[model samples]
Target: MIDIVLLSLLVVIAIAIIRMKDLFAVVMLTGIYGLLSASFFVAMDAVDVAFTEAAVGAGISTLLMLVVITMTGRKEKSTRHKPLSALFVVMLTGGLLIYGTLDMPYFGSADAPIHKHTSPRYINDSMEEIGIPNIVTSVLASYRAFDTFGEVVVIFTAGIGVLTLLCVARSQKNDEEIDSINDSMHQQHLVIRIVAKMLIPFIFLFALYVQFHGDFGPGGGFQAGVIFASAIILYAMLFGLSTARKVINQTFVQVIAALGVLLYGSVGIVSLMNGGNFLDYNVLSSNPIAGQHLGILLIEWGVGCTVASVMVVIFFNFAGRRAFQQHKKQAQDKESSAC
Candidate 1:
């Protein structure tokens, strides 16, 4: 019953998103949709996925979208092109996707191929093999460590791509007042600022707990990283970007991001040197279980570091770009008024 209701709400949100014209409202609705999706994940007992959806989808993604809207504009532009062809393509794709699922086993079927195959090993043997209480952590950080390494690399690459596109040159005139989108916000939201300052330290503490406590619980590096970045983002929102920059050096963040990837890769190389296959944790220590524990811990930390730094870097670049454009516009307005 809960599943049905959540699915229905998801469908409604999807339709609303398609129909909505106000980009700001659309972004807000999108965040709500993410929250609902995360709730659905929780109902399904996938708490780790729920945490990620809530943090990345509902929180970080929404902020990035809002920042982007500052440069793009508040309202969506009306297009002159007809939608008939696009509609036809979408219908075709949807039909094909539904068709593709026809031969799949029903949800929660114990006899499903996945359950009969990999799930059994993960469920029954993972504890003995990996010595981790959490099977998801065992699978992701141990059995699938290579895949996780690739995921970390992908995140680092995305940060590099954003940096390339949105890199803003620092202004030479340190004393000149720069107009910022957050200036009015910081001044107007005194209560929010006070409450956020109080909450920020607790948020950081929770992020650290999530980062290190994954072996026995629902959270791991990815969720923890986003949660950590979010606290800094909140600070920047309340205190202004310049102050946040002083607190967190952009160059140091970039370095940390790179080092994280290196750390993950280094574990694999060390395993190889120890006469084990790449990412084989068994070779790290005489006791296989201890090696697994050590390897998982290191890689998870690497993932956390990379993810947190990348998220912050992306936010900083987007916010900085928006500030630059605003400053340029203000300067142009002043010049025109003088003329």
Candidate 2:
């Protein structure tokens, strides 16, 4: 009865949120949707998945989308109410989901086909095949390590995409131009700068812990990279881009970011060459355990570097573009005066 009520409330909220016309309201509703979905997942006993959805959808994803919305402005004008392509896509996907569900075991059945088949093998063989205590981790890092590696590649690609889309290099030029146009707009915050400087080192140390502690807990490359990048972003926001650049040079940062991906890819290639399958980390060290540890470490570091550098690059580019724009404007002003 409680489940039914909660589910009904979720449905009602979803309808209300969907009817919201304001884009700002929609963004807020997205957060609400994330929270509700996470709640539902938790109720279903999928805590890990729920935690991820809550953090990503509510925290990072929403923040990122808000930033983009602020940068790009609210909304595009609608051409028509009819969305034939959208309708077709939705219909096709719904049809597929229904078709798949039709063959699925009945909900809450103890003797369901799902439980009767393959479940025993998973319960029994997991210990020997993977040799890990935690079945989930064993599956993710060992048995299904390939899938996780693919995900890491996708993350690396996304970092590259963000840098490219945001015109990180051009940001410097933009910054100069902004300064020129808004010369009187320059504001100082010495207190914040000092505070940020004090915290920067500690922030980085925590990021290191998160990156290295993935074997035992929920921390990992994705979290570590984002945390490190966020610290730099904070520094820039508080102190100024010039100060941030002094700490992390643009050219060197880009090289490290590229190197991270190369490092990860190289490990896989090395394993392939060592007579084991691709990414078979057993070749990294004499002991299988040591090799697995080494591989995880290398891959995690690669992920951290790429995530941190690419994020910083995006922030720098945005800030840089403003600076360049300001600089250009100043030059124009001087030329006009000379005329």
Candidate achieving the largest lDDT:
1
Q: Candidate 1: which stretches are off by over 4 Å? A: 172-176, 179-185
TM-scores vs. true structure, each candidate: 0.96, 0.72
117-162 per-residue lDDT for model 1 (tens digits)? 7888899999899998889899999999999999999999999999
Candidate 1 — worst ten consecutive residues by lDDT sum?
A: 172-181
Model 1: clashing residue pairs?
none
* lDDT string, candidate 2, 24-75, tens digits: 7778778877887878777876554665567556655565666556555676
**How far in Å is the alpha carbon of 57 misplaced in model 2?**
2.3
Decoy 1 TM-score against native: 0.96
Candidate 2: deviation at residue 65, Å? Answer: 2.1
